[model samples]
Target: MYYINKITFSMFITITLLWSITLTRIYAESRECDHTKCVKTLADTTIDMLIATRSVVAKNQDLINVDPVSGNYYFKGFVPAMVGSEVANDFSLMTGHKLKQTSLKLRNPNNAPDEWEEKVLRSFEASGYPKGAGFGEALVTGDNKIYRYMKPIYVEKACLECHSTKKNLRPEIRKFLEERYPYDHAFGYKEGDVRGGISITLPFGN
Candidate 1:
């Protein structure tokens, strides 16, 4: 009877442990799904805002320059920064760090501009995603409280007028870009080619 009771107690403990593990896994999965959904929603809203603003900016020539009061341009050549600011202001309510955009063109074989561009490309390949077109979110370290969301922006036919390697860009547009970004590496793009990415940062702790 004593041996039987001991066996029964051990079985009960084992069952309890199994139940705890199962519950933990369920909770973890629930949390992950919630996080994913939140991030996706934010991305969708951000994309909508960016596309709308881009359309307006593309149409109107006057609102292109930096705002004298805010010191922010409506459509900065840096796509990532524009997207980041929009997301931070509209969706994230200026919470945490703002998003950032960066562009990468086919290296000139003469001078590559920034290191981040190469790093983004390598990361895209290593992640097993498509080389030129992909998007995702990642956690940024430093107390593990920040998240950086990234999405690739491919060049389209309309983009070529200003982005191509050929110097047929409108004189006014070329002059504006030259003055703003003297070392601009945001050109030399063809339609359907990977130009760069928009990165959005949010505080994980929030």
Candidate 2:
């Protein structure tokens, strides 16, 4: 009788552990779905607004910056402010976390050559939208609560003047960047590469 009881207890413990794991997975999946859907919706809405307004106004043109080193078009200083105040404000109200946009340049002048560029490229290829395709979304954290949606902006021939390595970068711009960001790691990118990401982060609770 004692042996039988011990076996029964072991079986019950095993079953309970399995059941807990299954429940945890299910909950995680559900949370992921919710986060993904929220990010997608936000990206779609922001892109639509960008497309509609690109022709008429240039209020947000600062969001897109050109790097002279690699002829890459990327996001510059004021872009983050614009995103936080204008873009992220709305997203936060809708979702939970305050949204922010960031651009990681293909190469960094300061940091050691980590695989940062490669990782971004891989992520972009696997997850980013096609060239000029504009509009792809991804969940940053595995839980999917924090999400990023980005649009690809290809550098044009005209943009080469400011974005190419051959050209001289304006001193003012360089100074501005240095002062604002002591450890800026975004620079030296080529045309048609992933410049930056428009990210919306949902709060932990929500």
Candidate 3:
């Protein structure tokens, strides 16, 4: 059972309160902002809402500083790469922007990387590539323009429950993966291996 302390309970309540008036809160906060800044703020704050809701770990809720573009967050658990396609899809639909959790070793076809993303993924796999550094670019193709940002996700010790070597993967987890993701290749990873990347695409200036 997950036990909540005084601080955790207060945080839980805060998340509830924040979610209750999400649209209103967001609109009020971004109302005076310019277009690009508004969208970025919306995305950043929405991700804050997501991390606040999804994090349920006990003990210390450390404030982790991430890319300034992505914004900072206080999450008790791993929220970066650990957030799945479901959350990414919800974020995209809610914000009208693109959020993708993709991998070269795709477990789901829906999370397959595009050509540009594929190149980025390969670069992430390179031994000399700087770990945890994000790659971003603004591209213009005729009138269709976007800013693409990708941050690499690494395997952690906790991820081994399902993402370790075939023999080491728990029987139940392996069975479930076989049933749900028959073409799963998101395994055989040791700690610190580049798992994949979280790619965010914003239209125009955002």
Candidate 4:
């Protein structure tokens, strides 16, 4: 199996978000199509962002400094999940939509799934669900309608650093996680397991 170790986590997402930034404006024209076509383009754009991000980050790791300071065992401030959250926030601001990363087992309690997200996460976990396929719906809330889009994120061999079984985690990484996220259940994942997903909400009339 291919793995790039732990430090590449932030690099992976940073690159992905950058890809989203550049392409969202380019693909914004596609949203003027019919309702079904609009939502489909949005989801497709995000997935394409992933494809391009992985390819770009693979070629560009020289900028990522994984070297550790004396006492600290692993990198901080830019962990995979944290970077993902930040990336979502920035992307949301740029596009005037709500972008979020959420998981059934959360590292950041702030990312706890709402009712809709919870139901979707359960569906993702259910056996026989298609791997890597995204789910989307137009939700009616109060007097407004909105489109919610989610695409699942799968665990890779590279993800084992912070999300593998407890026994498999390096002591310092475990300790760092314990102190940072005491209620963490975002671990014990195998390579192909569903890690979580990218959730986006577009205003109804947008």
Candidate 5:
């Protein structure tokens, strides 16, 4: 009778510990998913708007015009790169997570790729821009505390204003880009070429 009671007590303790551990993990995952869902929504919406703007501009060149003298122009109060940089900065400021566009051939020095970003871009290229594959995800810092999302950006005719080769670029546009981004490597891309991507980082559980 004494031996049976001792065995029963041991089994009860073991089950309690297991249940506690499982609950902890479940809570952690729930927190992480909440963070990921928020970031994913923002990132996806921003990319969709950016792509839609590109399409609109491609269909109508006069939608946006360059102002070499003032070095600023607006179409509905948002320029392409301006919109990207603004959204990234604002989101990072508000949420404490980072979001921005990055590429192997980066035009803006600020948009330079991080380690994981470079790897993802290489994967896309090596895969020959496989159909229906436009995003990548991974954990950062060897921990599940943070997650990354990347969405591809493709070149459209509107992009050629600043992204075309020397011959294709307008003189004024080329001059503006050269003065602004002297180290720009984000040119020479044709329609349908994968230009780069919008990357978003989110912090999971505290």
Candidate 6:
């Protein structure tokens, strides 16, 4: 009877242990999905705000003077590409998340993609989703922290002045681009083309 009681007690303890582990794993997975959803929402909001701001700026272009050299409207000194970089930097400082507008044909070298980013970019191209319909994936960084979110950026009519081909560019605009980015491949894009993307890396703790 004593041996039987001991075996029963051992079995009960083992069952409890198994139950605890299962519950912990379920909780962990739920938490991971929650974090990813939150990050995706934040990333989408950021991109929307950016697009609205750019649209406003683009609409106001007619009010500004043309660049004496470029012979095109100066956009009140707001270049969308330059503005995006600065905004991304400022937004990162405010949110503690890494944000960037990256591309294959990069105007700013800083926008070059890492391994995971390259894969996501290719996936976006292949997915056939409209530019506004962004997609995201959850990934574990080297430190085992969860990172998420990516949004595609489309070229607009306003974007063509700087991003279109040399044949389409004003003499001053081409010269300015040459001086700023000699290897600039970001040009030749048309309105409605998927120019690049915005990626947001959420904080590690979240």
Candidate 6, 113-185: lDDT as tens digits: 8877777777777756665777776766676565666777778888787788888876757777788787778
- Candidates 1 and 3 compared by lDDT, better number: 3
Candidate 2 residue pairs in backbone clash: 68-164, 71-163, 97-203, 103-196
Tens-digit lDDT track of model 5 for 51-118: 55444535444433434345354222223665457655754665566767788998889888988888
Best of the candidates, TM-score: 4
Clashes of each: 3, 4, 0, 0, 0, 1
Arranged by TM-score with the best first, the candidates are 4, 6, 5, 3, 1, 2
Runs off by more than 4 Å, candidate 5: 1-46, 53-61, 66-79, 138-144
Q: Which parts of model 1 have CA positions greater than 4 angstroms off?
A: 1-34, 59-93, 105-118, 123-134, 137-140
Q: Against the true structure, what is each candidate's TM-score? A: 0.53, 0.42, 0.65, 0.77, 0.67, 0.71
Q: For candidate 1, give the lDDT of residue 66.
A: 46
User: Would you give me the overall lDDT of model 4?
Assistant: 0.68
Question: Whose TM-score is higher: candidate 1's or candidate 5's?
Answer: 5
TM-score of structure candidate 1: 0.53
Model 3 lDDT per residue over 1-206, tens place: 12334555665466556654774565355434445555555545554455434433211233321222344432223333344455567556765657777889977788899999999999999989998777767677678666666777777665565678888865645675788788888888998898887777766542
Clashing pairs in 3: none
Local distance difference test values of all predictions, in order: 0.49, 0.42, 0.63, 0.68, 0.61, 0.64
Measured by lDDT, the strongest candidate is: 4
Deviation of model 4 at 130, angstroms? 1.1
Residue 76 lDDT in model 3?
Answer: 28
Better structure of 3 and 6 per TM-score: 6
Worst 10 residues of 2 by lDDT: 54-63
Off by over 4 Å in 4: 1-17, 20-27, 30-33, 47-65, 68-74
Candidate 5 versus truth, CA RMSD in Å, comes to 20.2
Show the lowest summed lDDT stretch of 10 residues, model 5.
1-10
Between candidates 3 and 5, the TM-score winner: 5
